[model samples]
Target: MTSALSLDGVFLVPPEHHVPDTDRAAATQLLGCDDRTLDTLVRRGLTVRDDRFDGRDLFNLALHSGTGRTVPEQAFAFSLRWMRGTAESLLAPRTLSFTLTAACRCADVVLALPRPDRYGGAVIPAPEADVVAGTTVSATIRTEGRAVPLRSPVLRGLVEEFAALGVRWVKLPDALREDESLVTTHRVATCESASRWLARRCREAGYAARTRIGWVVGMLDLVHAWVEVTDDDGETKVVDLIFAGFAAGVPGANPLLTDPAVALRTNRLVPTGFEVGARVARHDCDAPVTVRIKPVKE
Candidate 1:
């Protein structure tokens, strides 16, 4: 029964027959499941309306139930659904409110707050925080980002170039030797390595680029790294090969590679800078600092 479903969890219903509510038989057929499996899915929290089902709900159920595919395969599928808008719930929120807290045991810490102008988001009453030893500092920030159309003409060429580079980078074999310098190696599998590689490539091609460590607000909010490229016209844009590579299932093709606006839609950037204050003892500030982020529900 599971074999009937797509590995990436996308099941497209023909437009002519698309409807909010589908009959039991049609729902089972669309989900590539038998009647018994459909019933089991409903019991597992799949919503049904008057003996009918929504395609999206079915898709989510299949996705969460584990498609028996590898992690990379699942990530690619989720990326496709996100780009294709089949998974609206997974899309980036227009307005997001979050709380950031940092704690250290030894020395005073300085942390950078998100700036509205820098992030291309609106943050009213800007975020502020003060960190002192043995105390936890916290701040709440609300940010908003406008959506950009994926088919914009101005970014078509740039987006295509980024997509091509991303595909090539992902296909490279893992490096056997561990080299710290970005110039000495090409093997990159993680976000940091990939961003560094892309930044070097961009600079070699005559574009100003740098690797940045920051937070990526998405379906899962976490700290991440990506590249920033500045064009000749003084416009800076984000070229996140790792994020775009998630949807680059086909060689030389990734529809998600567009303007920072489109990239921001799924992976919004929140740049973070850290400064360590005076230390009381030689190992007073040796303890690792921790950061916790929580999304505020409105």
Candidate 2:
């Protein structure tokens, strides 16, 4: 079933709309490096257009410049500032579209395609999926959507309430060490683990919450997991603990949980069923699947 929401009139800010910029002097100051070092970064592939440097380029250089060394706090702050700024810009109401395709060699296949839904101040209108079934199966799915400022009071209240749970965000390698049997069994959790934990907690609290597996679209799309919580009024909201923790630099702050201005820029959320791409099988026979995603020009 497709969602009833529509994104026809929303205005979306593309990634190019808010590329952070800085002069040479400001760039040096932000990186805490000398001109020569900055030049070295340029030689290493950092683009400097019209004497202005891109914040993302500078952040990457600073993050990986020194071998076996921790990134300086100043440089980290510079990255966070740019990230926050870009995220804020992406929160503006906007429309977007993408073409998604999946192919597999199998007699029977079920492709879990991108479905229309509302979250992060965005609404994805339902689109038709073209499916061809045979010895080889192929499906083409198109999605067009719009995002507006998230200002729901119930969502905001849920954010504040979840914050009271005090769950610490931990990335992998470290997160693997924590207990996953229960949310309270460990203080730190990764996105998937945390989402599952939060879903259970929300259900216990009399709220309808479910863990969702999908992709977080950005400069690079990555498999991600999050939660969807529905209020008594039947309104649903997204709860992404990992993104919230990273954006706010504090688990308690959780701006991504509700603050539209702090939304991820150059990045959007795409939820799917069970897994991304396609799942093809016939009488215990499984087929390998290939999936591709590209922006559709309107």
Candidate 3:
């Protein structure tokens, strides 16, 4: 009764393993098959041979049967529904860490790195450890984090709408009062707080949106947070609502969709890293993932 199944290039290992009743019920409906018929359809769906696109094709057919729309459109709608229903749950506890190797910009014999914080922003340090100009140094820090899956059209629209509302930077409060929520405060917000607030709004408005904790280097060399939304086309975009103002390519254009790298470069922040999705560890997790920065050679 065990069989392997693939979804969006990810495999459900031990395919015969039991799926929770709730999940099974959801999948049954999503696949547009009654409980009794799902087994046969799943078996048939998974039995395809070497065709690389079979999984997607099969999924599309199933969704199309249920939605009466093209697979992508249906997927878009389905992801939106999923996001709305599961938005808050995505903030479940997770671990995140960052390791940076950078050459000292000055001859102070020390390296200054922006440490990662739980809320996704950090203060620039005077300098830490021993190092010299053109010398490579490495440092790592670990902390608790929450991750949200931001892949859905409705979710993306929610982020865009929030970004269009304008963004401002707020200093972290001395202490967050009990019962005070980051959302609806709206005075000023850091990248992390802003993203979380946006996630909250998405939940309120019926979309699943997630606050992302990761590093953004290049023009803007800093550990930052942002919003992530996956669209129906299976593409994900990072929405830095805090920097929404910089996205003014055309007058009044929504900048949430602007590329972080491009936005940082335009702001003269000079991002050294453009990718997100750092390894998320559990509480106090300290597994070292190597990252090295080298000085330019003459």
| TM-score versus the correct structure, for each prediction | 0.49, 0.46, 0.33
| Tens digit per residue, CA lDDT, model 2, 1-298 | 0121111221111235324477998878656667887787566556677778666445444433332232433434443443444334434333444334334444454444554342433324343442333443222333222333434454445555555655544333322422345345544455677777667767777777787765543413445677676755565656666666555552233244335332222235555644211232222343344333444344
Residue-level error in angstroms, candidate 3, position 219 = 5.9
lDDT of 2 at 49: 74
Task: Please say which candidate is ahead in TM-score: 2 or 3.
Answer: 2
Q: Name the lDDT of candidate 2.
A: 0.47
Candidate 2 segments whose C-alpha is farther than 4 A from its true place = 1-110, 117-179, 250-267, 273-294
Task: Indicate the residue-level lDDT of 9 in model 3.
Answer: 27
Candidate 2 colliding pairs: 11-93, 11-94, 12-94, 12-95
Global lDDT scores for all candidate models: 0.47, 0.47, 0.38
- Tens digits of per-residue lDDT for model 1, 162-215: 455433222211241111242233222445666665566667677777766656
Report how far off residue 172 is in candidate 3 (Å): 2.4
Error of 1 at 82 (Å): 4.8
